[model samples]
Target: MELELRHLKTIRTIAEAGSLTKAATALGLAQPALSAQLRRIERALGGALFERGRYGVRATALGELVLERARIVLPAVSELQREAARFARTRRDGLRLRLGGTHGPLLGALVDRLADAVPDTTVTTCTSWSERELAELLAEGRLDFALAGVCGSAAPPDAPQLVWEQIAVDPVFVMLPDGHPLARGREVDLTALADEEWACVPGDGCFGDCFTVACARAGFTPRRMYETDTASCVHLVQVGRAVGLCRATFPPTPGLTTRPLAGTPLVWRHLLGWHPAGQRAETAATVLAQARTAHAGAAARSDSYARWLARRAEPQTAVRRRAGLAS
Candidate 1:
C-alpha cells in the first residue's frame, strides 16, 4: 500500500486489462483480493485510480498519470532485479569474474584465460545484450568485464569509472539463405541487394546504425521487412523473407550462409571494458591478450575469412619485407 513495484504493476495491469476481473486472472489473484488491493493503493495515493462502469474499467485522470510513471519505472526495476541476481550469483561463487556482452566467438577464450589466470576464481559469462548495456553493467560492478562491440564513430566517451581497450575492428557480413541468388558466392556487394528487404533489430544502436551507414555509403537505404534478433532474423532469411547483417565469426546456420560485403563498409569495433575498482588492474592486459588471441582463432576458423585476411595482409607483409631488405 506504500506504493511499491507491486502496486505499480497492479495499477498498470488493471489499466492494460481494462477490468479488475481480467487483471486478477492475469496476476493470479482472486477478483475480490485484487479489488481490495486496488482500494488500499488508492487510499495510500489519496486518489481514485479507476472508474468502474457497467461496460468495463477505465483509468481516471489520476490513474493515467500514475500509469505513465509506472511504465518507465517498472522496466528499470525489472532490470535492476536481473542485475542484482547476477551479482548475487557471482558472490556465491567465491572470487568470481562475471562477463557480459553480445554473443561472439571471443567469449569462450576470454572465459578460458580468465579461469587459468585467476586459478581459484569462478568465471561466469552472459551474452545477448548490446555493448552499451554491457558497459553500464561493468560500470555498476555487476560484471567484472565485458567484450562488446561499439560503433567506431559513436563509441562511448572515456569515463573515469571504467577503462575500455580497443581489441578488434571487423567487417560485418551479409547473411542470406542458401538458395538466394546472392548466396552463390563468398562475397556480395552492398548495392546488389538494394532492392531486397532487410531483417534487422529496430534500434538506434550499433547494428542498426552501422547498417544504415553502410547502405548510405553504398548509395541506398535498406528496406527493413522484419525487426528481430539474429536468431529470428535467420529464420526470416531461411524462409526467403529477408536478409540480415552478421559477424564473420558467427556460427554457421543451417539453410543459410554468410558473405562478406564488397568493401566491408559495415565495421564494428570490439572493446574490452572493465571497471577500475572491480578487478586488479593487472588483469586487464592479460584479458586483452587473451581477447586478441581469441579473435584471431575465430577468424582463422572461417576459411573464407581466413583467405580474406591473408589477402588484406599481403600489402602489409610486402611492406615489412621491403623494410627488412632496406635495413
Candidate 2:
C-alpha cells in the first residue's frame, strides 16, 4: 500500500534469500538498516513478512505475497520509465525501425526493399546481435520489426503486446560431409537422416533459425538437443559432428556437405515485428507499409516489384486522381 521501488527491491531480496543479513548483503545495505526498512514496511502493511527463526529470517505468508507482486510490478515499472523518456525527445515524428535477420542474405534483401519502398522513412539496424538478442529487443519495444527466419512458433503472440505478420517462406537443405549418406544423394531431406544426432546454433543465433525453419518447411521439426556457439568451433558441415537440416548459407564450416531437400519446401520464413508504440504516426505506418511492399516486391520478379510500387503509388494518386471530380 505504501512502498517505493527500493522498499520492493528490499522485500524481494529478503524473500529470495530467506535471511535479513544475507538479503542486506545482497541489497548492498547494512543489516540493521535493512531490518529497520523491513519493519517499517510491515508496519505500513499492518502485517508481518519475516519471522525470526533458528536458521535465519524466513518468509511469512505475507512476505511471500509481497515478493511475488514486486517481481511483476518492478519490471513493468522499469520499462514504463524507459518508454516515458522517449516522449520527451522530439515526440517521435518519424519512424524508428529495428530490423533483424538470421543471416546476411535476408539482411540485404530487407535493406533493398526499404530503400525502394520507404525511401523517405528512416531505417536503422542494430549494432550487433544474435537471434535471441533480436527477439528480446523487439519484445521490449526496441525494434519496430525484426526481419528474421521463422524457425518455429516460438515468437510472441500479437494482441496487447505484439503483432506478427508473415511475409514469405523458403525451402530447406542439408549440410553434411561430401561422402555422407544422403549427402551424395544430391538432396538433404529430413527422412534421409531422421534419426541423426546434430550440432546446433544456439537459440540466439542465425543457424538456430536455419535449423527450425528448414525443419518446419519439411513438414517436421528439427531435434537440436545440443548447443555450441564458439569462435573456432563455427557451425559448418563437419565429418564426425554432424548432418543437419538447413541451407548452405549457414556458417560454411569445413569437412561438411550442403544439399537441397528433395521435394520439401524447407524454406525461409520471414516476419515483421509490430509494436504499437513504435507505430505511432502516419509516417511510421506509411514507412512500415512501404518497407513491407518493397521487400515483397524485391523477393519476387523485378516486373512484379515495379508493378507493386505503382500499386503503392496508386493510393496517393487515386485520391488526387479523384480530388477534382469523379473521373
**Pairing residues by index, what is the TM-score of model 2?**
0.61
What overall lDDT goes with each candidate model?
0.78, 0.60
Local distance difference test, candidate 1: 0.78
Q: 1-327 in candidate 2: lDDT tens per residue?
A: 577888888888887787888888998889999888888999997899889997888788987888789989999997786466544322756545556555434465567666766666676776333555666676676666665545534453333556566655544455566667675554555655656666544444344555565566666665544555432223433644555554333434456555566654445555655555545566456545654664554445333223334655889987997886875
Q: Residue 61 error for model 1, in Å?
A: 31
Q: List ranges where model 2 is wrong by over 4 Å.
A: 1-3, 30-33, 40-48, 59-76, 82-90, 119-122, 127-133, 152-160, 175-200, 204-258, 265-268, 281-327
Q: TM-score for every candidate vs. truth?
A: 0.65, 0.61
Q: lDDT tens string, model 1, 1-327?
A: 567888999999999999889999999999999999999999999999999999779999999999999999997886677557655654574576777767666898677766766778777888855666776677666788888776655665344467888888887778899898888876899999999988764433666766777788889988765777767888998998888777777666689888898977877777888876556556567778878878877777776677667778999999999999999
Clashes of each: 0, 8
- TM-score for model 1? 0.65
Residue pairs with backbone atoms closer than 3 Å in model 2 (clashes): 170-267, 170-268, 171-266, 171-267, 172-266, 176-257, 236-253, 237-256
